[model samples]
Target: MVLNLGGFKFEWKQTSEIAIETDFGINSQERIANFEALLSAKLGSQSINLNGQTLPFAQDGQEALKPLYALAELRQSLPLVTGLGKYLGRFAIEKISENRSVFAPNGAFFTQTFSLTLRRDYDADIA
Candidate 1:
């Protein structure tokens, strides 16, 4: 798979899902638990860079949510495709260091990792 990480600098990984160009956006499950999207993109390139390591979209909340850019998981947002099927959005979240939980706040405690998930309204797919 080819991914323009930031600039034209792309990343090629051993892809497991086939890129799907549907009537609206792209879709693929080779990367997410259930692959599907609205545009035409290599679905296998969805993930997050944590401590310089790429991690799955969902990590079972075992470790802290790091403040880094990650690939958007399709299944986490497919059901909410609205208005001409606009399913492409740069979904990301950084660790809320300032908002440290006093006691299990935002599902966190201490300097716990928290995800800046697709805004609450768009939480149907990427959460």
Candidate 2:
């Protein structure tokens, strides 16, 4: 897995790419005023796609559906610890979007795809 959100894993097969974005939140005035100063900066938001597919070699489709289920059950009110390679931080799940896919007779899904939008939680007490 290339990334780990909370306790859910994002396998390389399921992920095409991982993108992390940072917004300095520096306005035009701030930039001009602090041109010679070492201004403070804030972390911005990030998003990722949690994609999975059931492989024929697998015994069941549960492995493909586990991350989807976990994301659906997550509480947006709380912040979750996330790690991507060596980067680690506390972030809140700002939004979640899922794409439709086929399912089996036993309710097992053939594929699971989700887009998660997260924002850094700056609160110091959010452990």
Highest TM-score scorer: 2
Q: Please give, for residues 54-82, the per-residue lDDT of candidate 2 as tens digits.
A: 34235434555556456647754333443
Tens-digit lDDT track of model 1 for 1-127: 2322112111223112222222323554454766554546543334332221122323323242231223332222222222344444432322212233344544544333322322222343445
- TM-score for each of the candidates: 0.18, 0.57
Model 1: lDDT to the true structure: 0.30
- The candidate 2 region of ten consecutive residues with least summed lDDT is 48-57
RMSD in Å for all candidates: 16.0, 5.4
Report model 2's TM-score to 2 decimal places. Answer: 0.57
lDDT of each: 0.30, 0.54
- Candidate 2 residue-pair clash tally: 0
